[model samples]
Target: MDFDQVRLHLNAYKENDQVIDAAKYLLYSFDLEHENFAGFGLRKAIPNLFLLITEGELGEPQKVMIPPNLFDFDLNLVLNVIAHEMLHVRQKSSINTVEDKNEREFQAYYEMLFHKVFPKIPNASDFHKKIFADKAFEYYRRMGENSELQQKYAAQKKEIEQLISILL
Candidate 1:
């Protein structure tokens, strides 16, 4: 959906502090760096809705595509996905290996869940909480404490904490 439609829907649910906070945070974060990338924008032209991140062809423009269906999608979930992808951008800037990319994505997904998504949807089902918590714990354990991986994880944790505070 376009920004206006999204704003209208959000205004309709204005009394929902959690929803309002989540939407504001997502929009604010997107605004901070959405344009620096080579390609970035919401795409309503496809059948299967998705968020796309692509490298520009022949030095063209890199982009991020957000499908229109995202407006009807869960706000917290969509924000988490966007935050996770944004973390990927950071990871791309620092890490080169496929393994590192996967690891960072794992960490980003956890960070988004615990910090960005969970606070906005505290009443999520027990199963949902268990799944994310388990994955996060598993990722942390695999990184091993006191290692560089753990240090990066800790930094991400701090960043998540700060972002949460800002949104709250």
Candidate 2:
């Protein structure tokens, strides 16, 4: 879908140069056009976050929700947040299952933590770093301690790690 056509949804569609510029940059840098998304949308009243909305029989990604004020953040930070949500879009469309929420979070956060592209950005503030530490390492730390959850998710973790390598 054309990024220019991203729906304003409930938002009153005021023209924002920042959103337009960032959309252009994202289009150039990522494989967004072919994803199984219904479209992109803008939400004005919600928290300042991006979201991937899923639907249909398999719960695949249907649309990406962008807060209208998202572009007010630092550009790198804005891109990173959008990239994170896009990763969710990819995970939902490719995996087609809502199960393994932990695995999914792990994979996405792993990318944010270790991937070369994601790591060099200066916008990953301490708050984000804290979440990355707490959530991303939860399963790996458990496995190291011999938690049974380790056994439950071992193969899946390995698969996700491999996928992370590819995504990186």
Candidate 3:
């Protein structure tokens, strides 16, 4: 999917999904704030206060960054990537290390699952396919052996699964 297609789907989804709307607002706001910083020479004078104000429910990330080659990927792959990014927007944090990166990814996947962004897989026949469920742990190896992050990831995984179980 290309940028246009992503925007098309997002426009549709945004009609009913407030999450996307809020994300766009935060993203655009951040962009405008940054532009002002450069335009008005405020980059070092003061921090972006809107960012510091909304700390937990929303953090640093405002926009979803898309690569130049996203148009080459399959639609499902593209959607999965978008979902992953939206999750990051939903739960951004102060990323300062590799462990932080991995943990954030795990959290994004958990958020995706909880939000039902994952495509369903019913038959065991297609188990080997690169479906959302199959490729969920593709980034896990980077997590290393950090037991605390692992435990947090596992607990949240289970919690999200249980929540999914109840809702679905």
Candidate 4:
């Protein structure tokens, strides 16, 4: 889907004008200039899985995969999911390793939910923080034990933090 379709979806689920306005701001914050970045699309491969698959082993453009049967899924929910997956693609390009995959996913989910999406809706960040914090701690704890993974995670984390600090 294109950005306009994504925006339409966002508008459908978002009733609050203020929340929608904030989401528009967040959407603009995403790195949309990347050549590899594409909007969401539906697939029939899985029954109910909404996956975002990137090209190649790494350093590939990201593709958001949504099941065709997402009629029941809320529009903003799908947008957030796509945003989270795109974060993973960004992390993967910066850090190379299989072990870092899980950590990157955790970091992306946490950062997107807490830093990006939370400001858009009332109490959304507060509710998601509890979830994100637990997952971030677990990922961080694992990274501490795995020296190689720690190095990779730290590098990617620093890169992401710097990018966010500079751009957002």
- Model number with the top TM-score: 2
Lowest lDDT sum, 10 consecutive residues, model 3, at 35-44
How many pairs of residues in model 3 come into backbone collision? 0
Query: lDDT by residue for model 4 over 87-113, one digit each (tens)?
Result: 655654534533365677656656554
Residues 1-168 of candidate 2: C-alpha lDDT, one tens digit per residue: 332333342122235445534554464454444356555666554565544343333355456666656654555455555556555666677555435556656666655555443443333555565555456667466444666656765765565456545444
Ranking by lDDT: 2, 4, 1, 3
Which residue pairs come into collision in candidate 3?
A: none
Model 4, C-alpha of 96: deviation from truth (Å)? 9.5
Per-prediction CA RMSD (Å): 9.1, 8.1, 12.5, 8.9
Q: For each candidate, give its TM-score against the true structure.
A: 0.46, 0.56, 0.39, 0.50
- lDDT by residue (84-158, candidate 3, tens digit) is 654454445344322266666676555445444333311121221223333346544456665666665676655
Task: Estimate the TM-score for candidate 1.
Answer: 0.46
Candidate 2 least-lDDT 10 residues:
3-12
Expressed as tens digits, the lDDT of each residue in 117-146 for candidate 1 is 334332234344445445555676677667
**What lDDT does model 3 reach?**
0.41
Q: How good is model 3 by TM-score?
A: 0.39
Check candidate 1 and list the clashing pairs: 1-68, 38-61, 38-62, 39-62, 39-63, 39-64, 40-63, 40-64, 42-66
Model 3 bad stretches (over 4 Å): 1-58, 67-73, 93-99, 110-141, 144-146, 155-168
- The candidate 1 region of ten consecutive residues with least summed lDDT is 117-126
State the lDDT at 114 in candidate 4. 51
Error of 1 at 100 (Å): 1.1
Top candidate by lDDT: 2
User: Which residue pairs clash within candidate 4?
Assistant: none
